[model samples]
Target chain A: MAGIVEFEKHPADTLKVGKGFSLAKADPDATPGYSGNKADGEALLADLDGKLTALQEMLFAESRFGGRKRILLVLQAMDTAGKGGIVNHVMATMDPQGVQFKAFKAPTEEEKSYDFLWRIEKAVPAAGMVGIFDRSHYEDVLIHKVHNWVTPEELKRRYRAINEFERRQTDAGTTVIKVMLNISKDEQKARLLARLDDPAKHWKYSGGDLKERAFWQDYMDAYQAAFDETSKDHAPWYVVPANKKWYARIAVQQLVLAALSDLRLEWPKAEFDVPIERELVERS
Target chain B: MAGIVEFEKHPADTLKVGKGFSLAKADPDATPGYSGNKADGEALLADLDGKLTALQEMLFAESRFGGRKRILLVLQAMDTAGKGGIVNHVMATMDPQGVQFKAFKAPTEEEKSYDFLWRIEKAVPAAGMVGIFDRSHYEDVLIHKVHNWVTPEELKRRYRAINEFERRQTDAGTTVIKVMLNISKDEQKARLLARLDDPAKHWKYSGGDLKERAFWQDYMDAYQAAFDETSKDHAPWYVVPANKKWYARIAVQQLVLAALSDLRLEWPKAEFDVPIERELVERS
Candidate 1:
């Protein structure tokens, strides 16, 4: 309540990809629906962070008591786009028990043996849990499309498979929320250099980041194409401008709050005779 | 700073097991080593919780740069002793990425097939991570011992095996800290009744809890025996008084901080050429 926000443009609308959405049209630095400065965004996030704990507990409680609903947040971004930041600041707000977090790296030999979706399916959130994927099934297309590892026909097939796979998840009571942390080329350059500039941050940097930056436009085009192919009414993608870290954090936190709020969860009614159990406990 | 305490006795010294330890000597109502009232205990937890995030990140950063050290906090307690609360408040202070939490329920048919340590071996903390076991391999002995599911000879064998398993963990750079949350019969009775009294908390109650409570004395005996058998130089056990929830949280958090601080982790040094990456990034 201390950092109450009445959004000039609600992220649910401004960030959602509509028909004919294009990567060329999105401005990486614009705070799309927010009328807040960095300080205001931080305050908004602080106010909202504590709200997640109770909702998460309700979800976990429901899961134990026959509730099938769960939440999945898929994070996709290029290097230095602050994907890890989202996981640290946003997803970690929930009790770790209620959060199932998996950061997908390159496929290992065992993973390569199966279809890409094989691992992704295994990582889906169970009833009443929130699952966060740092990089996900989207990699099979995003990276592969950039590298041309998959044939055009195969790429198209994989896209269709992904949509079907997500549909199955939703049908099984998982709400999929995908987020793309959008950073401009200049912002990324600044971030990568900032990491290199500091001794403590070296572990987060890799020489290959520069190589990937060269394919920036190609990756963006791949993302635009993937959104066009797979973004749906059930599982929509939201693009959060990440040039300002504070704004991106608040935006994603709002998206999470929106999805959980939609569940209309209530404290479940007691299934047993309260008097009987209390009497039994008192006697013990 | 707000909740700083000059300890009458540090938990490290007061709560640790000695040669002839018994659970009966641990007063669940006593706030050992902490001279604070409930309000003071709450302040201590708030001040201490913020300290974990930086420590956790340094450990994670170290792990990425080939540091082999990690921390493992094993939690053992009776029903309603607040194991779930510890995980939510204490362990959740760190990044979920750095914390691997597993709450052991009834072992499955598959688990029963393998040796008891089989499932546990797979869940040990990797380098630079902190692993918390809400209930651990001790259950294999505690419950099985209480139910007479194993012979005295088999129980002795399992105890030695657990010690050996933990030694291997420590030898491989894991600082294994085991804690048992001590609570009284009276307190557990109150907790069960409170759960039954509230509709929101009814989900946390189970009919089987009464059956388990009937074996309270037997379970306590089993715990004492297990501690005497398995407490070692490599993996010592600590008994924390849990009649006061705030005291338990701060005690466990202090144990966590002591374990991590003992490692003396510093921010990692830069592994790449700053000038080169800066030039390349600039040109891009």
Candidate 2:
């Protein structure tokens, strides 16, 4: 909500989470910032690929030569909301060298032994990396709240911890982009059915998914509560509509583009005497 | 190598390290399995992207559904030899979620305290991932041998340790691909000059690059000796002719395609009751 004016020139502003915003009021089918159709969205994504890839390379190069700026893109969404599609289509062109991706799952017994942030802290992108998290620390506030996995007081405490945790990331020069791939229950039903129909995609479906879907409204309430509690100036949550897969991909790509472009990345300057090195390389 | 005949249908065989292979004999300009010009190579690479990406996705999907198979593609070469290029162009299409890349540099104080393979072991990709090492344990043998950084006996021990390490990986359902992007000294010189000439690329240029180029023959000997000692049936090193950037990219892509295809991947079956899940999802 605070970033609406900050992102005024970008599509990100259209999806910005304003204070007291309700998920029910937003249309998952709405294109928001874009007036484009599916083909247009795809074409624009393709056009943005070059600038995105270049900026990513520059960011990576900056880290290698002694710079401390990185990007952490945290994606939160219902199942079949196309988080994976955003990664495959929007970020597939990036040099894997500069990309770090982790999809968090149910915590293991060992993970349960430590603070929830312990595993997350280890996965933070180092300088110059674009770290993509499929599901992240917000899960503690979202699902943990929805499922009553923790005490209500403990769940409330997690919100404060998440906000502070993200503030620290900003302190350490990590630009955090938190996104909720907003999709409707109907859209989820259709997608789940599509998965059920396709043998090739059956591996992605599970009985647990429906159990979660049964709590759809509760989950929506959970997401809104989490957003209200943790969304901040440095790492505000932007709810990109997910019903139209093409639009979701393009919007997320544009958000990343704006974040990187804001950094105004430059190729790191040579750390050696260029003239001397040039001569030496010439003789060799 | 032991894998030469095994890789005969692919370009990998043409570049394979046989029992008594000599680095001096291999021409960097030769396009072994391919007879095409640069344009044809580019066309083939474009054509191969679909299959490569599909295979990577299938491999990732398989891992998520109880499959344990994975790949470790170890890239070793001198400076400006196109290791990064191969990753950027060849792996650019695959989902970043499935890739884990590390560019091994000179070890730090903590890393140097452990066995050379400790950091390497940590970086090995988990189930269903493609782990790429820009430079790897082979550095302990190749560069260490070139610079006499380790005692000859200790350096020789590392070869044995590396062989056993790769064997253990294969024993654990990991397929290892070792590729030495073989670029001629002249090609290296030209590339270094090109980097020096372009301000944008200057960050990649290093004064140390010249110091390393001075020991070109030593590096060649180091590479040959290491290959002779450690290239095994499970992971024989492929000596790719890398002067033609297009040829190297295409050859490496084909090699990865061959490796993933060898696994005979299929879409994993639903782990839950499909009928029950479908019924629940529909009602929801």
Candidate 3:
């Protein structure tokens, strides 16, 4: 509640994609949220931590008290664009009991047998949870389009399906916060090179990453098309400028806090006799 | 690795249910794994945090590098018996990306239409991940038995199905760590009363919790039967004493660390020519 006042005008308002939004025109390095240096951004993020923690706790408490609402944070980004960092730094602040984190890797043999959203549907946060999808159902549209894995007609059908699926989730008391960590190619190259230079980070580097980088232009086009098609009001896509890790982290944290605060959650009332319970405890 | 050496004789080995094991004989207040005070246990848990984090990172890295094995932690406990505490305190130390936490609630209309494990099968952690079931497939047997929701024959069938399902997971490279947080009735009453006394915690308290408490002995008998029927070498269940929150948290952490260490995980070797990649990075 304390930090909530400062975030009345969220950076996400500018970053959120609307009709006919051009990904080509969006600057990946733009810090639209908080204009500050690295140190200042870090301090702001540290301050937001307590507010986010309290909000998540209340959300969980509300769910337990028969409140039916939950939140789903769908994060779609290119490789090395800091999805892992967001999960580790931003989500790690909340009580793990209330946070469900799912990283959608390439479809497994069994998963491939079902529809793409089948695995996703199973991972949707239950009531009283905040679900984070590192990479999600959008991958089917993004990579599949880039690689020509699906016919264009099939891709269009999948897009419609995605919209309906998300619509259903929102109708059923789920707030969908979809984010795309938009990082420039140069930034990605730098991040990849850093991983290569550090032996400890070698485990995270894969030969396939370079292969994907070769098709970066195609992937970008795919992302642009997917965003244009699937950016609905209920599940609007916010393109977070991820070149600056601190700014990106703070922006996403603020977006989440703002979404939760919008819910107007409060602690549920005790239905039983509190005085009698307190007396019982004292007597015991 | 330092703590791994100390855990050669895991306390879970003693707490584990063997053939003809009786839950009635188990003391829920006993701290078997640790022989220390709360402060000492907290210190020990802090030390294990780094080791657990390291091991989990290796496991995740290995999975990305094509390691097929995973870890599944099945936690089953009564209300107010500290399941949420175990998830928040013990499991929260791991990287969120590498850990999947699923808390099973009462079956939905659709979920009830399928076999109990149908929904659970969808939530098993993928390779290189740690899957924690806050409550799990075991619930069908535990609660259904207490409430007579299933016929005796159906209960027998469900027990068999659970064994076969877990066996399949193990065959597919998942190590199952099942635990029952054993808490005394008095401890549970005290916890419930604490929730009632605190306005902030009122949301977590429900009248149904009291109704369930009235059937405490029946629930205990149901759990005992479940343990006798489902406890196997591949998916053994450890009963962690839950009266002292610190001890329960530490004990579960030790059990998980020991299970992971047994896998002998390591940082995966890079497939590409590292020198060449390093050269390319420098040039770029």
- The numbered model that scores best in TM-score is 1
Candidate 1 differs from the real structure by a C-alpha RMSD in angstroms, to one decimal, of 1.7
lDDT score for residue B178 of model 3: 95
Q: Return the TM-score for each candidate structure.
A: 0.96, 0.95, 0.81
Candidate 3 retains true contacts at a fraction of 0.55
* Candidate 1, CAPRI quality class derived from DockQ: medium
Pairs in clash, predicted candidate 1: none
Model 2, backbone clash pairs (residues 3+ apart or across chains), number: 3
Which one wins by TM-score: 2 or 3? 2
The parts of candidate 2 lying over 4 Å away from their true place are A1-9, B1-9
lDDT of 3 by residue, A65-166 (tens): 688889999998888999888887788878888888777888899999998899999999999899999899999998899989999899999999999999
For candidate 2 chain B, the 10 contiguous residues with the lowest summed lDDT are B1-10
DockQ of 3: 0.38
Q: Which TM-score value belongs to model 2?
A: 0.95
Q: What ranges in model 1 sit over 4 Å off?
A: A1-3, B1-3, B6-8
What lDDT does candidate 3 reach at residue B228?
Answer: 88
Candidate 1 vs candidate 3, DockQ winner: 1
The order by descending TM-score is 1, 2, 3
- Pairwise lDDT winner, candidates 1 and 3: 1
